[model samples]
Target: MSVPDTQVVVVGGGQAGLAAGYYLRRQGLDFVILDAQATPGGAWQHTWNSLHLFSPAAYSALPGRLMPPQVGEEYPDAEHVVSYLRDYEKRYDLPIERPVRVAGVHRDGELLRVQTDSGTWRAQAVISATGTWWRPFLPAVPGRAAFGGEQLHTVEYRNPGDFAGRRVIVVGGGNSGAQIAADLAYDTELTWATQRPPRFLADDIDGRALFDAATARRRALDAGRTDTGGVASLGDIVAVPPVREARDAGLLKASPMFVRLDRDGVVWADGTRAPADVVIWCTGFRPTLSHLAPLGLRGPRGHIPTADTRALAEPRLHLLGYGDWTGPASATLIGVGRPARDAAREIAGLLRA
Candidate 1:
């Protein structure tokens, strides 16, 4: 349980962290990857059992590691992805310290202090491969605590059987909400909450037309272009099952967000009453940055700011695994690795100096 001081410490162990670790290994830098989970894979392991990659298998591999699934194969399920992460770690012999939650990161002279649950670690450079999609977000409704109803986030949902033979109002109009509602439509009356009509990407318009362009932009961490808060403009990303299937059903209907939570059901912003026995908040997630105490977080009501342009701030601080496009790939498992590779070079130079 003793925390040793390392030259470079990578926080987070998903695609981004692993990619950075790969680069560090090539550069022969001394570092350790600290993951909060008891396992290697990040959020992918927590995804619904049936969730699959939207990207073609050819496009999903990290810098050096190859995803075992064949190119253009149907999106591999979460099980495959999780297994592959373990394989990736084993193949590289990555120095990953699991279940070591970074509690705080602050300046300590020339090195960075990384405090975890068991002990404290130090490093001259800290690569926060901690991605943007960290904490799940569900809106707080009035009387939610008092409401006597089945409440759960979409993450906790396995399938429609969770609400079998019951009325379910799904909150949020993005990918998860649409799919969950559609799946439950046969047995349950479903309603979807939305700020406005959900902008769904049609099959023909969503995806990377060329790998070269996608690779370049990905390496850049293209976060500045996305709007403050909203779903990815799912214009083109390959025909994921969510869009096609949801569209096939009439369940894609999105109503105004619920104004309040009643003991019996949800009351809409337009003063409409909808009866519901279960409420699934498909509201999405927020980036986890509690471990980052030193980097003053951005925004009062919007998403993470991509405006910090300092590439060499404090000669040690670094942000990794941020978005590349104003696209779903940024949020998807397939998108994080390239940015991590680019970030590693920048970090190495800072340490070498």
Candidate 2:
């Protein structure tokens, strides 16, 4: 039995990973963060250029540092977020090794062996926070493969100008779909299709409201009360400036989901056809947990069941920033702090014991 390289090895450097690092450092733990990206900012760097936070800059902050507000922008865009994350890392002086993708995590006696592209690291505790950005999910609709025009996922979409002069269909009713559609509404011929009517949050609802609701729900559950059904009960889309403007201008109307795709367009169940040269699927993403396959903890839905943030089957392992399963709104920049702090404190206590 040899000494482990560190007490903990965080498997990402994105918002979630950075949040974990802040708490881990405060705990005075020996840890290292492994980020696949060569640079910082995590998934924010990869999002579409026009992407903006759902909340104001003042509310979309990490645990220790507040993100600087973007000048003249209520909702800071992707570039602002990337800049903030890069500076946050420098301010915190976190130990992060970039471009070192983790291959897998395996059990080694009492330690967890993390195999990465750079080298293998052994740790007493492992925080898997790779997130879902890398795993863009495209629904398997019939005849999708036969579509002649370009079909792209939310991950691949950049801006509306890219699809100019083309008949485009933006699929999904989520925030991504709404924002992207707004971006293309005036630039090109656009059709927004969703499984159901899109639901928009109240004008006042923002990331702060959502975070507060999530916190209340968490507190209710902890107190053994009936689930308050926090943010989940709210509408799906947060009417950000772009989305709101488009909606108010009657440019963001949603059509029922098309039945199938033809070479040139989509067909509704009613046999009405809408021609399209491009289909942008803003469906959603799955957690990036291929590295955890060796642990055999993922359930049928490709999620690892956990109590709080710690894996039930493997107490030494914790999953953060994936979503509510790890912790309520743990995927958000402002929402991840509580869970990250709790996980770090637990890991420190266990190692100390």
Best lDDT goes to which candidate? 2
Backbone clash pairs for candidate 1 read 205-235, 205-236, 206-235, 206-236, 206-237, 207-236, 207-237, 222-324
Stretches of candidate 2 exceeding 4 Å from the true structure:
1-4
lDDT of 1 by residue, 221-305 (tens): 4455534222243322234676467666655677888789878887876778888788888887766667775655545443334
lDDT of 2 at 180: 95
Report the error of model 1 at residue 289, Å: 0.4
lDDT of each: 0.69, 0.93
How much is 330 displaced in model 1, in angstroms? 4.2
Q: What lDDT would candidate 2 get against the real structure? A: 0.93
Q: lDDT per residue, candidate 2, 92-169, as tens digits?
A: 999999899899999999999999888899999999999999999999887898899999999999988798899999
Candidate 1 deviant stretches above 4 angstroms: 70-73, 132-134, 205-239, 294-315, 322-330
RMSD of each: 4.0, 1.6
